[model samples]
Target: MLIRFKSPVAADVLMLGDNAQQLLRLVGREGQLKGIFEVDDQPHIIELLDAAVAAEAQAAEAAADAGGKAPARPLVSLRQRVWPLREMLHQAHRERVAVVWGV
Candidate 1:
């Protein structure tokens, strides 16, 4: 299972794999593989957290704009949101999801 980011903020991470050459070769050969890899170099954890925060904020704002009552609490608290991203990275690593070289 490859993990691709919609943004290119993660390209720097491509350098961290022990098999960079093979990973790059695989990534280059398959368009589907390319879609799973993030071009952004940032750590997946940070990027994921940032994305989640942004998404949550957008959702909250949209709900407010639609005249729906903003939640008395955040839709997902910061703590609740942080772990999944890290867990995903860990799972991806353990599963060899993308031959991840970068953190």
Candidate 2:
């Protein structure tokens, strides 16, 4: 199965397994596994999510500045900011290793 979440202000998150490779292959590109972790490790997931949010914020600001408009406000709330990472833990493949976040 393939799962996707379209964020209002950031890149979309796509989740899928090897069985779904054919669908991705139709685009003439190979999909790479970026990072995967266990659900029991909350801290690791939190850090990854935080870094993603920060990066999104920075990109939005850069784009806005380049366009001569005010920077876009962060779409993530304080609470929801942590939700995606946590959700990833649950959704991630059990055999995958954790990707630690940079402080």
Candidate 3:
């Protein structure tokens, strides 16, 4: 179950179901198979996503620094996972395009 986000402003962004749900919740959206994001919501969502990515990176770094085997090697760094969404959101905000998941 992959979530594919589509918009006129950019190419589709795909995520695994779990990753997609996590992102949806992270962005304060309904974590459902299908949902819509209004153009006006993109900026705030992007902001939150940015914060989440930073937080995750910091956590991973801390764990590594503690000799906890984190190694700064996240199997799925939120930054990498969330980047396409950010790109899509930025494009949507600039173009007034709506983004949809599971379309």
Candidate 4:
């Protein structure tokens, strides 16, 4: 299933089910078929996601620094995958709009 996130202030953002669920998990909204990110909550959600991405990057770097077999790189990094949704959240926050998914 693909999740389509829509907001009045930005273009719709789309993600695969598992990927979308993982992103939602960062903000404590996982396992729902449908949900909303209210304007009031967007900033916190963004911060959580940014921190999670940064942590993932740091962990990957640490693994590489350990000098075993270099960790296999993901075709798409978490940061790249989350960019669109992050932009949507930022736009919604700035414009005081809510983002809704699975609508």
Candidate 5:
């Protein structure tokens, strides 16, 4: 399943179901099929997502610093995966609009 996140200020963002659910959980909205991120809530949601990404990066860096073996090739980080939705939230906040999905 795929989730389509829509906002008046930006193009819709499509994400894999599990990935989208994880992101929703980050923003304190888990197991929700239909929901909205109000304009006032965008900043806090964005902050939560950003902090999760930052934490992931920090953990990876710490492991490397501890002499852990690196993967043979680079993998797509959560930062990369969540960038579009993050930007969408930013646009929504800037436009003072809400983002909704499964509505």
Candidate 6:
């Protein structure tokens, strides 16, 4: 299924099942499908997403650093995938708007 995150301050962002779940988890919204972010949760969600992205990048870098005969499995890094959600969340917070996924 595709999830659409809508906010008044930015363009709508659509994500597929896996990608949507990834964003939900990164922003600590795994259980959320549609809802408004609490004022206090906006910054916190952004922080969590940032940390998750950084951690994934670090892990990918570590795997790359382990240069040897064993080829490292290619992983889909979050940088590109999460950009829209991150931006949406930032805009949501800035505009004091709500973001909803689905319908």
lDDT of 4: 0.91
The digit string of per-residue lDDT tens for model 3 on 41-80 reads 8888999999998888788778979987775565777888
Across 1-103, the per-residue lDDT of candidate 2 in tens digits comes to 5545332333444544442233223222236333223335535545555665576667777888898776546554433544553454434424344422211
Q: What TM-score does structure 5 among the candidates reach?
A: 0.92
- For candidate 4, lDDT tens digit of each residue in 1-103? 9999999889899899999999988889989989999888899999999999999998888888998676788898899988999999998898899999999
TM-score of 4: 0.95
lDDT digits (tens) for residues 1-103 of candidate 5? 8899999889999988888998999889999988999999999999999999998888878878989975443466789888999999999998899999987
Q: What is the C-alpha RMSD of each candidate to the true structure, in Å?
A: 12.2, 11.4, 1.9, 0.9, 1.7, 2.5
Measured by lDDT, the strongest candidate is 4
- List TM-score per model, in order: 0.34, 0.34, 0.86, 0.95, 0.92, 0.80
- Ten consecutive residues with minimal summed lDDT in candidate 4? 67-76
Q: Which predicted model would earn the best TM-score? A: 4
| Model 3: worst 10 consecutive residues (lDDT sum) | 68-77
Query: Candidate 2, residue 100: CA error in Å?
Result: 17
**Clashes (N, CA, C under 3 Å) per candidate:** 15, 0, 0, 0, 0, 0
**By the TM-score metric, which is better: model 2 or model 3?**
3
Off by over 4 Å in 2: 3-36, 68-103
lDDT of 6 at 2: 78
How close to the true structure is residue 88 of candidate 3, measured as C-alpha lDDT?
A: 92
Better lDDT candidate (2, 4): 4
| Residue-level error in angstroms, candidate 4, position 40 | 0.9
| Selected candidate, larger lDDT, 2 vs 5 | 5
Scored by CA lDDT, what does every candidate get?
A: 0.44, 0.44, 0.87, 0.91, 0.89, 0.76
Off by over 4 Å in 5: 70-74
Which residue pairs of candidate 3 clash?
Answer: none
The reply for model 6, stretches above 4 Å from the true place, is: 68-76
